[model samples]
Target: MPDRLDPKRQFLADLFDAAVAAADPRRILQDVLPPPPKGRTVVIGAGKGAAQLAQALEALWPHPCEGAVVTRYGYAAPCRHIRVLEAAHPVPDAAGIEAARVLQSCVADLGPDDQVIALICGGGSSLLPAPPEGLTLEDLQELNSALLASGAPISVMNDIRKQFSTVNGGRLAALAHPAPVLSLIVSDVPGDDPGAVASGPTVPGRPAASAVLAEVTARGLELPPRAMAFLQAAAEQAPAAPPPSRSTTRIIASAALSLDAAAQRARARGVNAWVLSDAIEGEAQEVALVHAALARQAQHSGFPHPAPLVLLSGGETTVTLRHKGRGGRNSAFALSLALALEGQAGITALAADTDGIDGSEDNAGAFVDGASAAAMRAAGVDPRRLLQGNDAYAAFDAVDDLFHTGPTGTNVNDFRAILLGELPDG
Candidate 1:
């Protein structure tokens, strides 16, 4: 493909690359590996980054450790000692059910001398869909779809998922019983809560079913009937604290770390960079509006931060699918941001998922700038209509602005950078 991005666009893209590189398992996972146990070390995990974590673990550990980890299709990393299983993500499927079973079996029949290293990261919630007893995978699948469309934040969705899951909320650790579990996590959630990542498979503590159900009702999320009924009954029963499990969690990589890395890169290039937050959340478009306001302020008023500055933020954003659109939250944010800017000059922004897949699309995300809307019109595309239909992919593709960086092998949620100042003339 022709190089369509200018130097300013390339600068934003470079920042994103720096952010993702900061979370690479091979670079960050080695120092956190625990000492090998005397009996056995079982490796089990699920997420977009699980396979990469397995590959890193296999390379770092001297002693032999064997187990399996599940990742999204097309995300497998080769490992000699650890098995890498592929499964669906953001939605549960039969393959995910089997993957969950494999993970469960991997940690079972272990002794106190044995140890389990959990390679946890984002997307594991969907990859390991072990439905609770009395509920079927179909029920969990239905719930998963509803949750994704409900526009709820990831943490809220995970709270509800913990109620219906067999493998989440530290049950995986409890299942490993006598064997201690050490969860090496790449956090994708806001606030860097280790328990919120991958629904805390190794970390203990499940909120009461009643509380989860209440939150669901408050959010107006319509779960499947079977799952809803189960939650109702479980809610009535005495809420029991989760059984104590010997599990230690370490957040090896997170959005904060990645954002810091991006800022450092910006500074090295002689641009002042200010990180807005590493935990920004809400509807993608709404969040984009806030970012647009900031960019405008910095560009026109020179308040908050002066010109030639880049504002950085990292966190997961949601896209409530009101239309049958073909774009993820990152793309949606870019589109909305373009509209909000109204062709304002001297402002360029990039929004992308660090995993190199935004929602279910092939592209990681897209770039937007002062001219994005004008370019869409010139291409005979209606940017407003596409944005309303939740089809930001078409908007960016119309302008040849869709950013692709296939499967980065690790994830730390969204990476957004907005640069204020015009690109220098060649």
Candidate 2:
């Protein structure tokens, strides 16, 4: 691990901190709040950042608000008027089942005069599970587990998830038909589509059940019989657009915004920074190889830009589990990057999730330099073997390079930065 005085690592960390700070609810939520409603203002949400988003709303909105929100365990933030509930993430639990009911109840029976404010963020698909009729939570849980290991993109997974859920696909907003709903979203998906985020509980639009089934089949996920039956029946029904509601969605934060913030911070420090893309998605290792190729281009030929530049990109990546590894897509990308950049000099990179939790692991992600692969070998660990085993966590840990930041009270998906050549002086 780099010491506290390591200028290169510190610079990269500063850029990441700036990106996360840009997405903090307290800092960005105040400006977009709607006017006080005529009737009751009920807040209901589900995600890793739902609690903090509720707390931010409470701090900003002077009008009395009452309701509940569900978040991942250990991510609850204090709220004065809104109730915060905790549940499992990446997989639904019984607590999530109950919380989903509570969320539905909050918006139920609301009149046109009332207002419903939904705080949606990443991890909500699992944090708020409402399986359709004839399907059990266990079925949903099993499907979720399989999807995570199937190496499918998040958008595809959510598309299929909407077919089997009672609350998603704008059903949550449909419940509060007469009431006006304002969905304040922190987008964690590629393209920042509000409907795609959290499976679009508040936003209306669902692919035909037939299309969803095709996606499921393409992914080769073996859902339970009841779950499969449910999809088939829905597909047999007449295709129709979801009922519209008085729902308006606004993306309060996203990977593009966060990447812009990081790039600005890098520029202020005199480093030439370029944001490659905020929606790069693919297999984790393959994405890392592309990034490595770009870095080498900048280092040797300066084709895209001169040396002393940091390449920034953000997007969710998927990993096909060849083994039961203890790492997320970000760590896998970092490990692959380490091997790809082996024997090169003066290249450093960081890949982590902005929400500060990756794949139920302790560290958000990992940091890799040109020498990271060699360092692992020095510690009696082969980087290639670990990568093949899908155990980047152990490889990075052996070199003391795992990045940890607990929970950052926000979610904007992946954050990655690669600096080639030498660090620029302030």
lDDT of 2 by residue, 1-426 (tens): 445627887788888899999999999898998899889999999899999999999999999999999999999999988999999999899999999999999998999999999999999999888987678899999889878888889999899899878899899999998999999999999999899999999998889998888878876777667778888888899887677589999999999999999999988887888899999999999999999998988788876678788999999999999898789999999999999999889999999999998788988888889999999999999999999999999999998999888899999999999988787665
Q: Which residue pairs come into collision in candidate 2?
A: none
- The superposed Cα distance between candidate 1 and the true structure at residue 390, in angstroms, equals 1.0
TM-score per prediction, in order, is 0.98, 0.97
CA-lDDT, candidates in order: 0.91, 0.91
Cα error, candidate 2, residue 188 (Å): 0.6
- How much is 330 displaced in model 1, in angstroms? 0.3
Q: What is the lDDT of residue 195 in candidate 2?
A: 90
Candidate 2 positional error at 359, Å: 1.4
lDDT of 2: 0.91
